[model samples]
Every structure is written in structure tokens, then in C-alpha cells.
Target: MRKRIGLLLGCLIIISIFTSISVSAMTAEEIIKKRDSNEYIKTAKAESEMTIVSGNRRITKTMVSYIEGDNGLTIFTNPRDRGTKFLKRDDDLWMFFPEAEDLVKISGHMLNQGMMGSDFSYQDMMESDKLTELYKFELIGEEKIEGRNCYVLEGIAIEGKKVSYYRRKSWVDKERFVGLKEELYAQSGRLLKAMKVNKVEEIEGRWYPMESVMEDKLRKGSRTEFVIKSIEFNPKIPAGTFTLENLK
Candidate 1:
């Protein structure tokens, strides 16, 4: 009886050690929070170019954007798309067309439609920083991407939560917390889109993706390359920049 009890105690100790190690490992939720915190700033200004490719055709548009918290305002600068404006306030998104002199509110099924014929949707523009609140995360494993070690994380939308992607898997750089690759899926388990970060640059002591490619799986031979021309973190954005009136 004494020998049996000692064996049981030894097994329990081994289990405890493994359990403690598991608990000490970084969690998926924590990693997501870190990435979000590192990416988002109180206020920022940026200039970017979006190049859309469809089969043999390619089009590029340039735009400038201002962001404050979850609210953002973007205006096209290229001659082809000049004066076009988009505003994202909380959960609402609106667009203004200079030529049509029309202001449109984007919601429901329209949110799923591509933005300016690009792979990005209007809903993708309204993504908030509070990822942990809307999704449950699981740390699947680690992998190497572009010569950098990354943590592989899978996220599922929480019940009753409305999100652009029902499921997502991301490869985030271990040290910089920047996402190197991401796969977005629909609720029915269909792959919708994939995003790859091609380059990263350090700006204002923070790591930011300088260029990224987004591919639409549902559309044959459709892809978009987004490049950040310049960005300023924590810049002082003028008041009313995110308001609907300013969208015009």
C-alpha cells in the first residue's frame, strides 16, 4: 500500500509540472491583444496606394487617411478617384462621391461588397481594436515566415458577435507583433481571402507593415496590393475629421 501511494504521488507531481508549463505559455488572446495594442495608436495620419489586379488589368488609387481611435476618415487623391471620401465611425460606415454628389451609408449586405473594386470590403475598413471582445483565440503553434519566427493563432467569432470574418488564422511575428500572414474564412468554413505582409518598417519606434497583398479566393485572378507611402503615429488630427460633414 505504501509503495502504491508513493507511485501515485509521483505521477501527480509530473502532471502538475506539465500543467504549470502549459499555464505559463503565452495565450492566443494575450498575443492578439499585444498585436492590437502595438498596431493601433490614439491618432494617426497616413498616405497609401491600393493596386487592384484582375486577370490582365491593373488599377491603382492613392489616398490619404486620418484615424482617431476606431473612427477614420479617408479621401482619395488620385485624379481618377479624387474627392472620394469614406468615413468610419464606430460601427457605421459612409461614403461620399464627388461626381455623383451622393452620400451613401454602407450596411448589411453592402458591407460585404468590395471597396472601390478592391479586395478589401467596407466592413474591413471598420475593424476595431477590441479583438478579444468579439472573438475567442487559440494558440495553434509556431511557424517561420519570411525568415522570421511567428506564432500561429486561430480565432473564432464569439456567439452573437458580428464580425467581418467568422474564422481567421494569423501568423504574427514573435518579436514585432506584426502579422505576416492571415487567412479569413466565412461562417460556412469557406475560405474568403488571404493577406500577406510583404514588408515591415519601423516608424516612430513601432513596427508597421509597409506593403501587403490581399487575395480574394472567391474571385478568380483577383488580388490587391496595398502600400503605405507615409505614416505618422499619434499625430494631432483636427477635430471633426471623422464626422460625416467632413466626408464631403
Candidate 2:
């Protein structure tokens, strides 16, 4: 009887190990796909507020944006930046300056720069691609973030793909499938940026990030907090809304 009990315990341990490996192998892709499905908006209109924090200084700005697939158009409504607009179509980005009456094509290194002096880069703001499309992910481990159980994964940029960050580490809530935190890294393995989601709410039966903070790791004491004031999902958007001519 004693020998039989020992053998049964050993068998249970082996089964547990295999179960863990199976989850690790399958969970990374499944988690990312579920997250993308929940968060990726096909068509939406949003009003948002951004507060740029540099040391003790704070600057606030507001904007309204229309988004469809990979295209978006944002127009600043704040007095200081009134009439400034940004339009993104395909992989191209364009900015219109109301003060200068000029339109600038954003390309090359400019894409890496901050958007409107905020912690978010132009590429960060304009990017609409899914994570699975950009990187190959592996489930590294699990941790708890803000009292919530999270699945931690590390992703390396796929070769032949253009990406802002060469490597990324993400903490996604296991139950909700929402991304709670992410760390972006440079090609040289240096930390470039980090984001933490502060609040989330159920919108249209999907969990949505309503407030978040993004920090530029290279810049000490500088961070930006973004809040979604309002959003309408799958609203009717007019044709040519993302056109360059509309920007002018």
C-alpha cells in the first residue's frame, strides 16, 4: 500500500508539469489574440485629454479623433494648439500646422519623436497594428499587478518587420485579458519607454483602457497621463476623412 501511494503521487507531479508546459506553449498566442480582439477598434470617434508632466510643470491639451482600421485623423481643439491636425493613412503620417499654414510629411527619424511634446511618439500614436503581427511572443512567467493576476510575456520583433521597439515585455491581466503594463526596449536592450494602465471600464461589452500613464525612460521625471473623455465605437465616418486634402 505504501509503494502504491508513492507511485500515484509521482504520477500526479508528472501530469502537473505537462499541463504547465501545454499552457505556456498555447497561452501566449491565445492571450494576445483575445486582447487584440477586445481592444482593436474598427471605427471610432474619441475625445481625449492629455496632461504632459515635466518635473513640476503640467501642460494640458485636448483633441478629437476619428479612427478607421489603419487610418486616423486628430485635430487639436485647445486654444494654444487649435487647428493643428494630424492625419495617418496606410503607413504614412502627415501633420498640418495651422499657424504656419504648412503640411509636413512625417517620415524617417521624425516618426520616433514625441507627439506634441508628450511622452507618446508619433509612431506610438499612429500605430494600429496588432502585437501578433509585429512580434513573436513567449509566455515567460506570471505575476500579480495591482492585486490582479497577470500573465507576463516577452516579445521579440520579427525579422523583416519595422517596429518602434525591438523587444517588449507585457503584463496582461489573466482573467480580463487586458494589458495592464508594458515595457518597451531598444535594439541594444536599453529600456526606452513604459506604460501602465490606471483604469479600465466595460464599453460596448469590451474592456477598454480609460486612463493610462506613459513614461519616457530616457527622460527623468517626465511622464504623460492620457484620459479618454468620450468615445463612440463603430460610428459612421465619412469618406475622405483620412485624406491629405482633408488635412489642409
Which candidate ranks first by lDDT, i.e. highest?
A: 2
Instruction: Name the regions of candidate 1 deviating beyond 4 angstroms.
Output: 1-24
Writing each residue's lDDT as its tens digit, candidate 1 over 120-184 gives 98878777778788889898888999899898999999999978889999999989998899999
Clashing pairs in 1: none
List residue ranges in candidate 2 displaced over 4 A: 1-25
lDDT assessment of candidate 2: 0.92
lDDT of each: 0.90, 0.92
TM-scores for all predictions = 0.88, 0.90
Highest TM-score against the true fold, candidate: 2
Candidate 2 lDDT tens digits, 1-248: 99999999999999999977876766688988887777888999999999999999999999999999999999999999999999988889999998899999999899889999999999897665588888999989999999998999999999999888999999888878889999999999999999999998889898888999999999999999999999999999999899988998
Q: What's the alpha carbon RMSD for model 1?
A: 5.6
